[model samples]
Target: MPVEPDPTRRSHESWRAILDATFELLEEGGYESVTMGAIAARAGVGRQTLYRWWPSKAAVVFEVFLDKTNIGPFLAGGEDFPTQLRAFAHGFRTLYVEGPAGTRLRELTGAAQTDPDLARAMAEQWFEPRRAPVRQALQEAQKAGVVRIDIAPDTALDLVFAPMHYRLLVSGGPVDAEYVDAIVDLALAALAPGATPA
Candidate 1:
């Protein structure tokens, strides 16, 4: 008798193909161009397969963004909190300034304004999880006396990340290394343990 293929391995392969196809389509033609049918065709899987995994094109695309743009490695840089933060900022700046991923993010940001479900999915899947590690790092810094204990980790994270988002979504300013460094410097100064007002 012929040996049977492993269902788990096959399922993993199929999922990878679907995600890869979704990104390829997104890079090729923006958000409006991607559809379940197109992703299935590109992945060489059936439409039923795509639908079985994701309810919509936005769902598929969001999963791809989460998998592809994980900032974990970026957050693990340098010898100290300030250095690590600067590295993270540079990584974030580069991601948004230099790839199809940025285009996809911008599309999603605009779509989220009109689609509450998409907005919730992004917040729950992408935003919260990504921020968790950053928050943990901040907490650790505070414990080590490098960061101010009084300020919430969420506030510190906002100070570090908000400028990048503003530049990406609103101001349309340059997110170059210099700009990223400046943001990191300002954030570090504010987050320093003794910087709080008396």
Candidate 2:
């Protein structure tokens, strides 16, 4: 028996279907192999629908990257910002270190080196959103007089995240728990007044 399509499902089905197809294509064939026609056919959607939603394949793939990964540690739950920040760090390390998606991330980031548009979109859409929670946590830390207010939030974010990106993209080293703890400690130290590096 044919399953009756749910109307609510139909409304957002195309978007979900598209992302699902993107993941499949990415896993099976990598970023270079993904094309609009292939994605549309995989999703069972029309080319017009795909074009209407995403201006380019890069945008579609970026969205799929966001959807498949947990951006922050906590999912907007009951924990305080700091606790959630810790959780977010843990989650981030898990994905960046051991997850299957890490390889795809490396490849896409490599491709972004030549593709300016993808690089911009990846930074704006994928990277910025991931940092938002840490930004909030830093703000909270400032209000509590734990973090020096002189340092800008963006700077704080960079201090905390830049190392991980450097390791992931450039150094090609392992992202272990010890590394995460060291990163958190160093970033926090920079934000502390009269704090000297040990």
Candidate 3:
């Protein structure tokens, strides 16, 4: 007699197909072309399955996007704050500028413009979790007397991070390894204790 399928394995496979299909669709037609029905059909899963796991296309999209971004703590350079900043910036270069992460981010962010729910999900799910570790690292550095405590944590995050993003989305400037090191160094100088805000 034939054995029954393993429910756990089957479930995992189903979700994997769904996730893969979502990205495939994203690459093919972008955000507007993706719909729940389209994802279900492309994934070879039932519409009910999509609804069971996620409420909408954006929900599933962000969920899968989050899975792709398990890069870990942003400032994992070294024990020292300066070292950590350098390492973090280099890692950002490798992943965001050098790798495909930046493209996916540009796509998601642009799509999030019209969809409030998607924007919120992207922030609450994708952006905030990744920012948490970096934010925590900054907090620890503040306690260590490396980063100035006067600046808000979120502001500090933007100070170091915004440059890369600006280049990625707006300036179309260089985002090379040299630029990464320069930005990190600039951030360190600005955030150094007793450094006055301009």
Candidate 4:
């Protein structure tokens, strides 16, 4: 008798194909045009495969969006926290400045405001993971007497990241290396021990 296919492994492979196809489509033809049929065709999987996995095209696309971006790996640079934090911001700025993924990210963020599920998923998946390194760095800085003991890690992350997100989302400004350095400088000033927010 022939060996049977593992259902779990098969399912994982199918979803992976769907996400890969979704990004290809997104990169080739923006988020607005990536249909379920297009994804299925590009993925070489049946349309039912896409449906069985995701609730909607947006959901599939959003997942692909996350996979295509380096929200985590970029944040966790190395063992050292400060170097990791700077590298994280630097890497993300490079992506925002250079890749098509940035446009997709902006679209997803705007959509998240109206789509509660997308918003929640993004918070749980993309946002939190990206903040983990910053949180770790903040904790270490606090321990080292570099940052104020009173400031929470989460707050520190927000203080550092919110401006970058705001610039990316609304101002449509260029996210450059200079911008990264500035954000890091500002974050340290605000959270550093004996320093007050100006």
TM-score of each: 0.77, 0.72, 0.77, 0.79
What is candidate 2's lDDT per residue for 36-98, written digit by digit as tens? 999999999899988876678877777787777644434356556445555666677777777
lDDT of 1 at 81: 77
Candidate rank order under TM-score: 4, 3, 1, 2
Model 3 RMSD to the real structure?
A: 5.7
lDDT of 2: 0.74
lDDT values for all models = 0.78, 0.74, 0.77, 0.75
Candidate 3 lDDT tens digits, 43-102: 999999888777677677676667666674556545786787677677776767654556
Collision count of model 1 = 0
Lowest lDDT 10-residue stretch of candidate 4: 1-10
RMSD of 2: 5.6
By lDDT, rank the candidates, best first.
Answer: 1, 3, 4, 2
lDDT tens string, model 1, 68-95? 7754337774467777777677877776
User: Which residue runs does candidate 2 get wrong by more than 4 Å?
Assistant: 1-16, 44-52, 73-85, 111-120, 196-198
Q: What lDDT tens digits, residue by residue, belong to model 4 across residues 90-197?
A: 877766666676677778888888889888887787767766666777687789887798867888777667788889888978677888889988777777678865
Clash list (residue pairs), candidate 1: none
Q: Show pairs that collide, candidate 3.
A: none
lDDT measured at residue 19 in model 4 versus the true structure, 0 to 100: 75
